[model samples]
Target: MTELLSPTLGGAAAGLGVAMPMGAMSVLLLQEAMRHRRTAMAAAAGIAAVDLAYAALATGLGPWVASHIAPVEAWVRLASALILLGIAAHGLRTGWTAPTPPAAEPRGPATPTPPAFEERGPGRSPGRPAPPAPSGPARPAKAFARYVGLTAVNPTTALYFAALTTAQGASLATGAAGAAFLVGVGAASLLWQQALVAVGALAGARISDTARVWTFRLGYGLVAAYAIKIAFPLPTPG
Candidate 1:
């Protein structure tokens, strides 16, 4: 048990180190946090749950997981690629239709009147209020499904853990150590993700509309790129 405790805790910390970077999922999570804190929390929890499941599967089943799960990885990659492409298309549409930034006025002579805020398009009634912003709690089911799908489709995540486990096979003794490592990794993941959600929620309030729009486009673009990389893996040495 004592031996397991150290390795498990160490593994957990290492897992956090690997996961802390702002990847596609992180960006998505941040975006969600900005839009809906509760939803973001649900999504983060789903991701962490999946990670723990994968970690346990990798640590315990090892090669068998690869053999059984590898086939599904292809379908998952395809689905993820399609989802990313859809998101990119949505971004492109939104970006194309987005209102252009008002040009700056000339400094000398006549001071130009600032463009009046248009609540609606031309011909619309001025008295009509703007559409209400979405304020309800995020849908837990949808958020969970989205994150779980993304995580499940991540090929690199599986490859990384597989490699790590294979290398550490000798050191991963059965009994308390194995259990401890799993617990540590799970705990670390939850802690790190929750922290990320909190930071994202706090920062979201300060984001400008233009900046938020651009971020959505950029984040989706990156996700599409990642999907492509996963779909068409680089050739390995024979």
Candidate 2:
């Protein structure tokens, strides 16, 4: 088992290589974390789960998947680009709307008092702001599902895993080495994704609402540019 540690270390490096890029999926994860900090762990778990699964597949059928996916890579890129654009548009739309506060009745005077906790709703408090509605989907489960699907469709992820596994000879890892390598990749990906979630939470806490909206707009623009580049890439000259 000690001898297999080398493979495990290699897998960790590969995970970092694949996950550290600033892409649309990463942007979405950060935005999701900022929106629902409590559920960010779940979203992070979803990210790791897909990574683990992909690592396993790469270990098992790396060569076959790599060769087969190359032919259809363009289609996958298009799909991912479209999904990113859709997410960007929806987020912009949601950001435009202001959160609605409960209407208040005048308390024996011309001025209206803000609604009390009970007046707002059950288990609600004046100190706490009303929760922002989720941008992509209504609930955490849906968000998790959305992340899993979106991340899976990213062609770069599959290509990354396929290349990494092939380079590391994952097909020959066998037994303990194989298991360790898979675990190592999963651990690395999980750690990085959770860190992103924490950073996003801090950003949400420290920044003003206007800053959040503007940052989101900036990210959306970048994602749109990436999508456009992927969708209509320039032709190579002979």
Please list the Cα RMSD from the true structure of every candidate, rounded to 1 decimal place. 13.5, 12.8
Q: What is the per-residue lDDT of model 1 for residues 1-238, given as tens digits with 9 covering 90 to 100?
A: 5667667765675356334433345545655676678898888887787767777776785534334545454554455455545544544554444443333222333222211322211112223333222233459887887677766655545554444443344355464555676787688777767776886688753334465355445544554554464454433334
RMSD of 2: 12.8
* Residue pairs with backbone overlap in model 2: none
Compared with the true structure, all predictions reach lDDT values of: 0.53, 0.54
C-alpha lDDT of residue 43 in model 1: 82
* lDDT, residue 229, candidate 1: 49
Error of 1 at 118 (Å): 34
Sliding window of 10 residues with minimal summed lDDT for model 2 = 115-124
Report RMSD for candidate 1.
Answer: 13.5
How do the predictions measure up, each by TM-score? 0.53, 0.54
Off by over 4 Å in 1: 63-137, 205-238
Q: Give the residue spans of candidate 2 off by over 4 A.
A: 62-138, 205-238
Candidate 2 lDDT over 118-236, as tens digits, reads 11101111243322323442366766775676556545456445545543342334767767778887998789788878876776432234554564465445445544644554333
